[model samples]
Target: MNEREEDLRVPLISFLLCLCVLIGGIFLFLYLFVPNLSEPWFPPIALILIGFPWLLWVLTYIYTCIKRCFGVSRNNTDSNRQISRRASTMANSRMARNASTTNGSNNAKEKQAQLGSASLNSSHCSKSEDPSITSSQEIEMPLTTSAPS
Candidate 1:
């Protein structure tokens, strides 16, 4: 009932009518002109009639896939711009935070210490890395042996 649905309805109905006309015309031609056609010729003629629409649909699908792979869609371009904008905003926020922290009168040694500690604390543990173990110091392992029979 809405404008969008009504717009789609007209085109859809027209397409179906055109398809019906095409199929009907093909059958009518085959019936009239190929009345004495042999069995061997019948399958090829029928296949050609049926396959035209199928071929068109397949070609259209492939064209759309190729276009999508090449990033020709407007929606894809819009999403890329949005992603870059968000990344830039995050970087700007981080820069502002760093500027605010270093604005104090702290000397080089104190500033370096504060920055180092902040970095160490701010670093998050990834899913694959354990948070409980902080140091890279190697641990001694006990040697395993089979019990004497």
Candidate 2:
């Protein structure tokens, strides 16, 4: 097949072989120790030190290889970039909506996309010392209330 597929397959197969060797080594070590018939030097200390992180390294290698096989090359770097992009998009939309609402006109919104992109500045934010509000502006209300017959 292709070189890319070949590259992935090679590492995956190598890791699988390493994993098999790890399993066999563990079983053999346990079997030898459980019997207690072997000499003190039967299981070496070098093996113990190497064994500590060997499985973890092999598993990671195999995981990367399999992921490459499936064409999922995404990593933490891409994740960070995607998250930042999404955050910026959300912030932009929120700003646009707030600008449109404060200005109050659908036609104006359609006409001035650039103007609709105003940021929520300090001038737009106000604090009220009074809890309740009063307005002198009068509005026309329904003169009669109707109920379904």
Question: Which runs in model 2 stand beyond 4 Å of their true positions?
Answer: 1-41, 44-49, 75-91, 94-101, 104-149
Find the 10 residues in a row with the least total lDDT in model 2: 131-140
Note the Cα lDDT for every prediction shown.
Answer: 0.51, 0.49
Q: How many Å off is the CA of 60 in candidate 1?
A: 1.2
**Stretches of candidate 1 exceeding 4 Å from the true structure:** 1-3, 8-45, 73-149
Global CA lDDT of candidate 1, please? 0.51
Q: Please give, for residues 29-93, the per-residue lDDT of candidate 2 as tens digits.
A: 76577666544543564365446556667899998799777864546534643454444445555
Span of ten consecutive residues with least summed lDDT in model 1: 134-143
**Reference-based lDDT, residue 41, model 2:** 49
TM-score of 2: 0.28
TM-score per candidate: 0.31, 0.28
- Give the lDDT of residue 127 in candidate 1: 42
